[model samples]
Target: MSPVRQWHDGLQRYGLVVALVALILLLSILSPAFLTVSNLVNVLRQVAVNAILAMGMTVVIIKGGIDLSVGSLLALCGAIAAGLASAGFPVPLSMAIGLVLAVMAGGAQGLLIAYAGLPPFIVTLAGLTVFRGLTLVYTNGSPITGLPDTFLVLGAGELLGIPAPIWVMAMFFASTHFLLRWTALGRALYAIGGNEEAARLSGVPVMRVKVFAYAFSGLASGLAALVLTGRLNSAQPTAGSGFELDAIAATVVGGASLAGGRGNAWGTVLGALIIGILNNGMNLLNVSSFYQLIVKGLVILGALLFDQLVVRRK
Candidate 1:
């Protein structure tokens, strides 16, 4: 490869690492607590949900699609799980039902897009509204609480002195990394997103890949719901409001293309951590919520600007 190509590849692969190091340095300068193990673990716990969602989002984006319904899907799943558990259902059974519902919701959206020829944006947008309404209807806008400790343990319990959510995130990431890097299915997803017409011509099974992406998005949301409900010990109809944005922001900041076909699980994970640290730092330093909003917007803008610069240079 040419020198410039090598540099570009390196940036694409390790940009998240560089961004993370810079963020830690910046936050440590702002507060010594930022470097403490406890604070760092806290940030990881906070970002765990977003990171999980973003990894799912990465698959869809890699296949040149988007899933706007994930936030609502998460809320719906959490509500379902909480309601079932409260009614004395076995915790495992409740979780199973939640997973099934999530898969069905996502599969419906994928069917609309792939078979009915609906646009992904439109289908998932409809999903966003429908799932939100379903959540409210299911819970009657009331939060469900007092979940079984078994379910809660998955979300709030610890293993080896580390938070359970962190361990879940780590295992999921490792599996996803292997799936994307070593599987034929993973390569097909990239090919489809990189160029659908070409991928089809090359016999990449575009429809199957697209469907899998959406279904996986649902699965991720369901898993996220498990942790979220456990952490709060309640399930609110609006629990995941705006979570979709966080997942999207993390993917983009980690250099995933809004245009698709160029991102990774590890990069998305780092992006979530960067965002978590930034939010934690702002809260710690007593920054006004208004300023925090402005800062976040500016940071997203910076990432987009960096994307544009990289593309132009290429």
Candidate 2:
């Protein structure tokens, strides 16, 4: 590679890490409480759901696709389990049903896009609307409560002296990293994202790989739903609103190209931490929610601008 090209590549690879460290330093200085062990644990707990979703979003984006329905899907899937549990069904069985539905919902949308030639944005957008409606209708516009501790353990319970959600996120991050780094399916995803037509002509199973990508995204939503529902000890029909944006922001900020064919598990984790730290700091400093939203949007826009103006040239 040319000198400039190598420099840009290195920047793209390590920029997020640098940004995360800088953010942490800034936060720790701005708020003495930011470095406290309790505050750090709080940040970890909050990062779990978004990080898990981002991991799956990374896969779909790396495969040259986007999923706008994940937030709504989380509500629908979590409600399924929550509703069942409220009706006295076994915890595992209810969770299984919810997870299965999430996978099917995600895969069906993927199939429509891959086989029927529908645009992914349109299909998932429709899913976003449809799933939200289904969630509302299923729960009769109310939240499901009366959850058992057995079911809630996945969200609020600790394992090995660490929060369950943290462990869940760690396992997900590792598995996703391994898949993208080592598996043939991972190669197919990247190839398709880099150039779909060329990849198909090169004998890549483009459609199947795409479907798997979407389904995996669904599974992430499923897992996130369980944690979220557990944390709340109830499933809200309105839960996960705007979560899709958070996931995309993390994926984009983590060095993934909006144009596809780039991103890594570590980058996403760092991105999530940067975001978590920023939010935590903001809350500590008494920043308004309105400003926080603006800041978040600008952060995402900055990532896109950096990718387009600096990295894409190479």
Question: Which prediction has the highest lDDT against the true structure?
Answer: 2
Q: What TM-score does each of the candidates earn?
A: 0.96, 0.97
The sequence of per-residue lDDT tens digits that candidate 2 reaches over residues 1-314 is 78988987788778888888889898888889999999999899999999999999999999999999999999999999998988999999999999999899999999998999899899999999999999999999999999988999989999888999999999999999999999999998899989999999999999999999999999999999999999999999999999999999999988888777888888888888888788889999999999999999999999899978766476
Candidate 1 contains a number of clashing pairs equal to 0
Summarize candidate 1's per-residue lDDT along 1-314 as a digit string, tens digits.
Answer: 99988998888677778878988898899898888998989989999999988888988888889999999999999999889998999999999999888888888888888888898999999999999999999999899987888989868999999999999889878877887899999998888888899999998888877888899899889999998899888998998898988898888888878777778887788888888889999998999999998988887888888888887877
Show where candidate 2 strays beyond 4 Å: 1-7
Candidates' RMSD to native: 1.5, 1.3
